[model samples]
Target: MMLQDIDAVIFDLDGSLVDSMWIWEQIDIEYLGRFGIALPDNLQYEIEGKSFSETAHFFKERFQISDPLQKIKDDWNEMAWNKYSYEVPLKNGADSFLAYCKANDIKLGIATSNSRELVMNVAAVHGLEHYFDCIMTGCDVEKGKPAPDIYLAVADALKVDPSRCLVFEDIIPGILAGKAAGMKVCAVEDAYSEAIRAEKKELADYYIKDYTDFSSLY
Candidate 1:
């Protein structure tokens, strides 16, 4: 009955479904290092929930870098592609959880702030592309997490009512986004968001430390 009450499930890709958040941190270090700019201590937390385009703009403005916004995104994508394609692994129990959703006939969607090319690459490499009925990137929407645009778009793509959707997210902004879209959100635990775990729990409708924990939902 619980499963029946939810028509669709949406997941965030990075920290929520895969263990690739560290890659971005390292990339930031290296990218800024190229300009002899040391990354700010609070930069990661500040930009944790921003869309790909927004993050690129932030880097250009904050660092006073000469690169165009698109160029910054392209360079970061280039640096990240190989790692996402080969090194990133699924979060604990993600495989089984996705299988469960598919077997249960739950409409599955992915709404991510990552680049479309990289998202497809990672999904294909992990064999997750088949599980998603709809996979939308930040570029597909006008705004990103905390703005509700991406999640709303995914819900539309899946042809599901936002009120009947269940979202799994790792960051506070993402949790806020799902809630703003009128969906119930489960905050997934990720080491990248450790500092804000308590905050996430407060913001989400439910809190799950791992995908296996969803066993109770059945």
Candidate 2:
């Protein structure tokens, strides 16, 4: 299917444009270790598209952290940010895809569930800031992914119609949010297992195994 009508493309940061989900896995292990809980071998599918507050609630409730959830998230952010500062790399074919969007005059923006500080820093550290017309984070909205708020806000800020923009997402909640906002939604495979893949396949309009598959998308 041709994404010929797409005038803009919005990207989800962690798993879609950059392979940073694995970083979260490492952090989860360490965080749980500090609390003497055995970390699950997998955390991505549960955590994707959730905000700090929401994630904190999940960890707290699931593992009984006992502290205020916000504090837990803050501590995690402090720990994660240190590594996020230097380790961001564009996923395979992402830079080329960005270039393709630019060359064709398609508007670009980042609509991520990540914090603004982390998102901005990663974009700059990897020289991706210049390609985007706007950058928006989940903090900017009252509702994060699974709610249309962030994607809706990014489309608004870009001054584009929602129908004219497409979204690249790695999780079902994000895909649902984008589609609910009346945009075409595409999924980028980011190391999900078969079970995860079957679960996420239903939410996205299209699925791509790699960025190379997105080359002719527009």
Candidate 3:
């Protein structure tokens, strides 16, 4: 992918910018267990690109959960906090890629479906807060991935045209979202999304196994 005309690089946090996708599945299993509900096989697929609040609502409605929305979200945050802080790490070579963008005067931003609190905490833990000019959660906008809202909002916040922004995304909805925003989308590889790898490549403008693939470009 050429960076010649790109003014900003936007990332989807969970599987694209960091190795935290596994953490969510674990949280789902444990969270649902609390209500004595066994996780459905297609639960992840059903909630693939939903925002944090949307997911909480899904659980409430689908599982007939009695807890208020905020409580469900709070429980998830509490369960995932320690894992995100200590166990999760940046994607391979992501730090170098971020520094490369910074050195080239390219703006950086995060457009994620995660909650703002969790996203901010992850950024703090990874020392990534300084690298991003904007950090937008899906709930900040009216819609989440598969819609252009979050990515468009991030570009707008950065004062960059969507056409000049390049987006790195891991899942199908996110890749579609970036493209829908008119940004060049790069499909990133992640273990969690391996099942649909071919579709991701077909949908995105570029495909990369990891940030290390950019080494040849620089």
Candidate 4:
């Protein structure tokens, strides 16, 4: 892929750009224990790029969990949200990569499965909010990643063709979403999540270990 043909690069936050992915594991261990159900290691990767509500809904069905999982999410959100202030680390080279995009006139934006408030907080906390021309959250669309709705919405907001947009994702669902939206997709290894480096074969158009002169693929 060549960067020259790309007009915008949309990113998936959480594991892809921020260190918050680990917080989810913590939340899983602590909360699921309250219900006495061991966290299902198999579901984490499948569930990335899902909205909090969607996740709650999933748990409801999967574990026969009671309804109004909203309260559980609210509690988890409270924990993870605060962590963004001092704990969430930006993925290595992420800041510099965004700077490079800005310098090169590449429009950047976030299309995340997280709530708008959560995404905004992470971006603001890391001083990454300024780089995004648009930030579309799962709440803004009927479907989250793997559905293409969010990415299409992002492309519309960026005023760029979906095919001209390149996506960077750390999870398979996010990559499927980008690809379904008709864009080129690139994968990033997320050390903290189940998206194992070895399993990256299915998630990325190009698997990148780190951002190093990496923007040339447009």
Best by lDDT: 3
TM-score of each: 0.95, 0.86, 0.98, 0.88
lDDT of all the models against the reference? 0.89, 0.83, 0.93, 0.81
- Model 4 spans with C-alpha error above 4 angstroms: 64-69, 193-199, 213-218
Q: lDDT per residue, candidate 4, 128-156, as tens digits? A: 86899999888788887789998999999
Local accuracy of candidate 3 as per-residue lDDT tens digits, 116-141? 88899999998888999999998999
Better TM-score candidate (1, 4): 1
Q: How does model 2 fare in lDDT? A: 0.83
Clashing residue pairs in all predictions, respectively, total 0, 0, 0, 3
The TM-score ranking, best first, is 3, 1, 4, 2
Poorest stretch of ten by lDDT in candidate 2: 192-201
- Residue 105 of model 1 has an lDDT of 86
lDDT score of residue 173 within candidate 4: 78
Candidate 1 residue 50 Cα shift, in angstroms, is 1.3
What's the CA error at residue 25 for candidate 4, in Å?
A: 1.4
Highest-scoring model, TM-score? 3
Candidate 2 TM-score versus the reference: 0.86
> Candidate 3: which pairs clash?
none
The C-alpha local distance difference test score for the whole of candidate 1 amounts to 0.89
